[model samples]
Target: MEHKIKVAVNGYGVIGKRVADAVEAQEDMELVGVSDVTADYRVASAVAKGIPVYASTDEARQQMRAAGYPLVGGLSDLLGKVDVVVDCTPAGIGAANVDLYRSLGVKSVFQGGEKHSLTGHSFVAHANYKSTLGRDTTRVVSCNTTATVRTLTALQDAELLSKARGVLVRRATDPWESDHSGIMNTVVPEGRIPSHQGPDAQSVVPNLDVVTMAAKGAHTQNHLHFWTVELTRAAEAEEVLAALKAMPRIAFVKRSDGVVAVNSTVELMQDLGRPRGDMYEVAIWEDILTVQGNELFWTYTIDNQAIVTPENIDAIRALAGTVEDGAESIRRTDRALGVRADFTATD
Candidate 1:
C-alpha cells in the first residue's frame, strides 16, 4: 500500500469543510481531523460526516463538549498527526496560526485573505502548481483572483494576450451569511481603483498585465466579471475560445441556453446536483465573446465559496510532493472534485 499524506483542516467554516471533504476524496491523502472555534451546525455537519472534530482553543473545546460534540483532541493534537494543515480561518487568523504550524514542522496552505508575503507564493494550480512543490507554505489566491489567473493565463499561454482590464461585480456575502451580512438595497463600488484581485492574480502569473475594478452587488449567489482584453494581435473569436477551452477547469455556459445570468448558473449547479450547488469551474459565456481587431470582450462568473477548493487540494499535493507532475495532480483533483469542462451537458 502507498503512504497517504495525513491532512488536518483548521477552521471548519465555509472553505474549511469543503477542503476537508476534498481531502477525504483524494486517494493520496488522509483527513486526520478538523479544528474549529465554533460548535455550531457547521461543526455538527463535520461530526455527522464522521470527520474527527478538534477544538481550535481551550474555550472551543469546552464549547464543543457542552454542545455534546465529540472531539479527538485539540488543534495541536490534530496538527501533530497531520502532514499538512489547510488554514481556512478568517482573513488574518490564519496568519496568526503560522507560528504553530512552523513549530510542529507541518506544511500549511492559506487562503488569499492573507498577504502575499505570508507565504511568498500565491497558487493557481494550472498556473503555478510546480513552484509550490515541497514548499513549506502557500496561499491559494481568492476566488476572483483564481478565476482571473485561470482565464488570463490560458490566453497568455496561447500567446493571445497583451494586457487586460476587468470589472468585477462581487457578491455581497456568502449565501448562508446573507441574512446577517452583505448589502441589501444598493450596489456599492469598491473605493480602491484596480482592486486587489488584479495584483493577487499577478502573484501567481507575475508577468500578467491586468487591472481590475470591483463593486458589491445586492445578490449573494456568485460574482460576475466583465473583461476587456487586448490580444497580442487581431484574432478571431474562435481562436480565443479555443485558447480558453485548452485550459482545465474553465468551463463554458451560454446565454442562449437559458444560463443567462449569475442566478441561472447557480440554479444550473443545483440542477446538476453538485454538492451544495457548488460550481468550481469559472463559467465563461462563450457565445457572447467578441473580438474586434486586437481587443476581446467576454464575461464570466465566479463561485466565490467553491472555486478555490480544488486549488487548495492541488496545493496540498504540491507541498507534500505526493504528485510531482502539476498536470497529473490537477487531473487527479479535477476527477476527485468532479470539475468538468462543460457544465451544461449531461456527463
Candidate 2:
C-alpha cells in the first residue's frame, strides 16, 4: 500500500476548516489534525466533524482543555505529526511561523494573506504546478489571486490574452465573521492601483502583465472581478467564451440560467447540497462576455468563500511532489469536491 500524505491544517476558521475537509477527501492524503486558537464554538464544531483538534499555541492548550474539547496536542506538537502543515492563520501569521516549520523539517503551505516573498514559491496549481516541486513552503494565494490566474492563464494559453486589467470587488469579511465584521454597509476603496493581485498573479504566471483595481463590497459572500483584457487576436464573443469555458475550474453560468446574483449563486450551491456551500470555480457571468475590436471584456464573480479548496488540495501534492501529473491531481480533486464547469452540477 502507498503511504498517504499526512496533512495538518492550522487556523480552523473558514479556510482551515475547508482545507481540513479537503485533505480528508483526497484518496492519498490523510487529514492528521487541525489547530486553532481555542475559540469555543468553532473548535467544538471541528470536534463535531470528528477532526482531531489542537491548540494554535501553548498558551491556548490549557484553554482548550478547560473548554471541554479534547486536544491531540498543541501547535508545536502538530508540526511533528504531519508531512505538510497548511498555515491558514490570519495574514502575516504564517510568515511568523515559517521557522518552526523549518526547524521541524515539515513542508508547509501558507494561504495568500502572507506576502509572496515569505515563501520562495507562490502557487496556483494551473499556473505553476511544477514550480512547487520539493519546495518546503508554498503560499496557495488569496481567492482574488486564484480567480485572476485561473481566468488570465486560460486566455493566455490559448494565445488570446495580451494584457488583463481588472477591478477587484472584494468582500469585507466572510459572512460568518460577524463578530469582527460589519463596516456600516460601506464600499471602501482599497486605495491602491495595480493592486497586490497583479503582482501576485505574476508570481504564478511570471511573464504576464495583469493590473487590478480593488474595492470593498458590502456583501460578504463572494468577490467580483470586472475585467477588460486585450486579446492578442481579435475573436468573436463565442470564441472567447468557449476558450474560458475550457479552463479547468472556471464555471460559466448566466442570468438566463435563472441565477442572477452572487448570493443566489451561493444559495444555489447550498440548495444543491454542496459541501459547506462552496462554489469552487470562477463563476463567470456568461452573458457579459463581449469582444470589442482588440479588447475582450467581461465580468465574473468568484465565490471567495470556497474557490481555493481544490487548489489547496493540488498545492499539497505539488509541494510534496507525490503526484506526477498535475492534471491528474486537479481532475481527482475536482471530482472529489464536485467542482464542475457548469451551474447544473451545483443546481
Candidate 3:
C-alpha cells in the first residue's frame, strides 16, 4: 500500500548478504538496513556501501565497533524504521525473532531453514506466489526447494509433468564456509529416502508428486540436482530444453564447453561477470538432457547460495502487491539481479 516497502535484512551472512543486495537492486523496495551478530568484512562491506549496519545487542555493537564498522544504530533502530524484515539469520534465529518482528508490527520473511509451520505461508514465488499475496509473514523456500519447485512448477503449469524424483547432491557448506566447513572426504548419504526437500516442495506446490534422496558432497559451491520428471506424454530432448528454456528462472547451458563440474560452473558465472559472482538460475545442462518415453531426465547445478536471492525479492513484492502477478515479479527480479547472470552463450 505504501509507495515503497522498507525492508531490513536481519542477518548479514550468506543468505542475508545476497538478500540485502537483491532488495537494494529492486526499484520498488528500500533496504532500510541490515543486522548481523558477526562482525566481519560483510558488515564492513555494508558500511562502505553507505548501508546502515545494526547490531542487535550491546556486545555485538561493541564487537562491530571494535572491528571498525561504524554503527548507525542498534537492532531496534532497524526494526523501528522498516516496514518488513527479512530474517536472513542462521537456521533457528529467524524462529526466535518472530516475536520481535511482531512486537514491532512488521511483516517478515524467513528462509527455508525454518520449519514450514514457522509461518502460515511458505513461499516459492514461481510456485506459490499467489498463496503469499496479501500475507504479512512468510518463508522463501530454500535454495534446493526453489530449484526443484521452479522446475516442477513450470512443468505443472504446462500440464506436462506427471511425477518426479530427484537425487540431490548437496554441498556440505556454502562457498564462504568451505575453509572451516569440513569437506566430505567421501560422499555422505542422508541414509533415507524422501528427503525433506520433497515435502518442502509439496508445501508450496500441493500437487507436486516428488520424492527425493540427498547426499553431501565434499565441496561447497553448488548443489547438483538430478531429476527425472515424468510428463503426461512423450517428448523430445529438444522439447524438454524448450520447456525448461521457456521457464523464467531457468538458464539452459547450451554446451558443456569442457565445463563439467559445479566449481567450473561457478567459475564460468564469475568469468561471465555475474553480479556479486552470483548464479541465480538453474543452470541446466541441455546437451545432457534425455528423454525416454514420457520421462525427461536432466541434471542442473543450483548455485545454492545465490539462486534463492531473487525468490526473496519476489516474495517481498508479493507481500506488498508491488507486482500483482508472480511471474512478472520473478521477471523483474531476474532482470534486475541478472538471473542466470548471462545468456549471450546460450543458443
Clashes of each: 0, 0, 0
On TM-score, the candidate that comes out on top is 1
Candidate 3 residue 92 Cα shift, in angstroms, is 0.9
Q: Which stretches of candidate 2 lie over 4 Å from their true place?
A: 345-347
Can you rank all candidates by TM-score, best first? 1, 2, 3
The sequence of per-residue lDDT tens digits that candidate 1 reaches over residues 1-347 is: 67999999999988998999999989989999999998989999999999999999999999999988888889999999989999999999999999999999999999999999999999999998889987999999999999999999999999999999999999999978877998889999999998999988889998999999999999988999999999999999999999999999999999889988999989999998889888999999998889999999999998999999999999999999888899999999999989999986778
Pairing residues by index, what is the TM-score of model 2?
0.96
Q: What lDDT does model 3 reach?
A: 0.84
| Residue 49 Cα positional deviation in candidate 1, in Å, after optimal superposition | 1.2
Q: RMSD for all candidates, in order, please.
A: 0.8, 1.5, 1.9
List of clashing residue pairs for candidate 3: none
Better of 1 and 2 by TM-score: 1
lDDT string, candidate 2, 142-198, tens digits: 899999999998988888889988998887888788678756677898878878889
Give candidate 3 regions above 4 Å deviation.
340-342
Backbone clash pairs for candidate 1 read: none
